[model samples]
Target: MNLFQDIRALVIGALEIMQADGVIPVGLDFANVTVEPPRDPAHGDMATNAAMVLAKPAKMKPRDIAEALAGHLAADYRVDTAEVAGPGFLNLRLSPALWQGLVKSVLSSGEGFGRSTLGAGQRVNVEFVSANPTGPLHVGHTRGAVFGDALASLLDHAGYDVTREYYINDGGAQVDVLARSVYLRYLEAHGQEVAFEDGTYPGEYLIEVGEALRRKVGDAYVGKPEDVWLEPIRDFATDAMMGLIRADLKSLGVEMDVFFSEKSLYGTGLIEQALDALDAKGLLYEGVLEPPKGKMPDDWEPREQTLFKSTEHGDDVDRPVKKSDGGWTYFAPDIAYHYDKVSRGFDALIDVFGADHGGYVKRMKAAVSALSDGRVPLDVKLCQLVKLWKNGEPFKMSKRAGNFVTLRDVVELVGADVTRFVMLTRKNDAPLDFDFDKVLEQSRDNPVFYVQYAHARVCSVQRKAQEAGIVVDDAMLAAADLTKLDHEAEIAVAKKIAEWPRLVEIAARTHEPHRVAFYLFELASDLHGLWNKGHDDPSLRFLQEDDVDTSQAKIALARAVAVVISAGLGILGVTPADEMR
Candidate 1:
């Protein structure tokens, strides 16, 4: 079904024949050999740099090897012609029937056509949106949530066992700030005027939490001192904030397989165990770090602290695990959490962090490397900020979230599907502009709408075909004579369909789910092109009156396009629209 992969196999087979016939040296490495679509369609259907890659190693002219390889490749039934291009690059034109067969394959396979086994059943843990348990998720966390969820789905589709995880930062001082903020709201509920100081959360959403606390305990904590109320309220407030966060994530169609609490690492011996694992490997030691290069803190006196030898595993410098006061640093628990993941037998670990956390990437990777003894690989993806715009102006701050745009605000403005798809329209590390006006616009420039429109158009065709008394079942269309689909526009659509399998493999390999959005745009464009061509040529239309056989063949192609669109959108966690409303 993968035409590119099939041809690469053929190329390798031909090269091996060249070796057996003594035309090329035996045991030449074919690992670098690749067969992919040429940059320009004029070059050929596919191109390979096998000759150029092997020239210096084999001590032979590239053209001599390319010419010899071309002769062997041209003899294959699938390869119509193989010609030497610039600098001994081999350009190949596949037989027209091969492309024709690809369309039929898509029809037969349905949505499963593009599924790949490239991951080989490896277990991968993807931790994302570990936003502090201080408030409901904001606009920035929304992008990371969508990106990480889509990445998990993409890897799952490509044969990886993916676990979506969320790390709760309840052990930090910020959650303490949340507790104090809720305490102010509690006081206000007791008919006492309260003011939010500089560090306390000032959002009105906590008013409900205050009202609920008043309903539960009346005036018990109203006249109590800080000691009597602080611990109990901290636990209650943390749980409430987690409830709100879970609801927000649910609204965006996200669910986590695990919710690891940083507090759990403190009470248990987990943090100590994780650091001990590193220490046994000679990675932990007492050390003094130099002051910051540009601007040192006011209290910048150097002090000996417990540190991890992160430099051995590629970090810029060793990082502190314990402060000079013998308290665990913020990074110590994170290292322990990753060690726990490594001990769980995952083959790989992935962290989707915000771009602001870019400085932590190297140290985190080093921790995982040392903890896992280089057996497990960790990939860190940084999600950039999202700037919101509305009515052609910057969208102001949210009252509910105090100083930021809440995730609920976004989901309310545009439904969950639009929110998810628009967030992934850019690479994870690139800034995203989520313009409320532009995203909901029905024009082709809006990627979510454009891709949805393609699926809706296919549904319209199916409805029209069925109303005209034509059999539109998948089995009937799949068995139709596909050779009747010979138009250039039809072939171009089929070519795009062929790219789906290859696209999934590439996106999954790179762990970049944004590429799926890009591929959907291209697929939608190809489908729209075919739809427009029908207006100019009646024969290109999916419904053909008085010609049931040809109509079924064309409908098969249209349905296959919808099938791929639905699958791609499914990975994005965006519901494909059957009709634009």
Candidate 2:
């Protein structure tokens, strides 16, 4: 059970009782009332704004409302003290039994302790890392990959049916460039000297694709014209590049459920069908867009184009869907793809894009809004650039990946677990610095190591308890005499554990996986703080040499911390370290 939700319900019940009687006026809305942890710990365990938010409608002084609410809430056995603070706040300190009982709840529930039902079975689609199959994935795509995968996992944890997806941009002219690049390599494989022009992809990763083509066709199209060899080699090279991309994602532990191709929308009339839907809604038009704000209308020549009236759905201007040449713009296939997702009956849609795509956000949202008839909600998360560092200097580029840092380069330098965890230390929209030296360092300054060290510390304590011939199993720990855990410092750590469920719901609702990382760091800090206290004061140690019940109670608390840490790490797709070297 969620303690925060339980306390909120109790507060709402008190407000309802006050409304029914003459204490407060009838028909006053209490929807705005909230129960959250006090900002300052000295105030109380939990605070409520019921009195202040309802005072205007109830026509009573804030203190009067607070006084009445406090009296009503203090009657509950869980409320050890309820004090009326400034203006209209009601702060309540819960009995120590509740905090101590949280340890048992954590042990009993295990990894499922913080799982939430906030989504209520809504089906959502998360599309991310739709990188062009031109080369191996670079660091720019790596941030989006990790963020999308973790967000999808977060949604699953919060009771949503989530579909992880990748949209391959294979229909564009970029894929044509890829085909030509592979063709050059194929010529070289056939013992013909070939030159890579400006438009060709010259990465070494594509050399294998060229050799595979030679092996498959046996120089059948060695000297053929462009038209003869273009189509077949395009398919072959795309397949090969996709294999490399999948392997790159595997190195980072990111797996997607669906890989939708942009090429499928072109010949199948999917794009036309989506445009027809918009046409029926009168959201499509044929016209010339106005010039820039500084230019006069007469200064610009008229160029007729097919456009979508995206301004109806909150975009700043109508977006062009087709040029005057009757060719589809990049926006057309994107609209069709999102329409397909909506047709699949996903209640909501999310797209994770690199920060360079910020300008595309409004137009895409408008397209989805028009296509879905405002029935589905769309959220776009933009991941900013990641600046790599090493030994207090900016990390250099990968020689293998000519222009940028390759995803494989990062995963190989640091393990996959460290790469994934370090990428999520900052919010998706904020710029992140991935320090090669700092992230792997075993110090308090490194968040990845700090959180993992806490989990490892708990394992070490459990091992020590076992060495002393103490059985520290979850079943026995759950039933331990937790009343022995009455110290203020011990109770503080239990309170941090209590915040996990609430934090999960908040992070899931906001679609921010970084909050999970931030919360784990705070939880680890508390666990380590308590462990240090035990060093100076023998009574605070987890293992007591003489008594079994007391030892079980203390060790239960430590084990509970590990349970939450493991679950948090699991959500991030990082393995928990049992021991750090």
User: Which has the greatest lDDT?
Assistant: 2
Error of 1 at 448 (Å): 0.9
Identify the runs in model 1 with alpha carbons over 4 angstroms from their true place.
none
In order of listing, the candidates' clash counts read 0, 0
What would the per-residue lDDT of candidate 1 be over residues 49-140, giving only the tens digit for each residue?
99999898889999999999999999888888999998799999877777777767887787788898989999999999999988889999
lDDT for model 2 comes to 0.93
After superposing candidate 2 on the true structure, give the runs of residues whose Cα lies further than 4 Å from its correct spot. 293-300
Model 1 gets an lDDT of 0.91
The residue pairs found clashing in candidate 1 are none
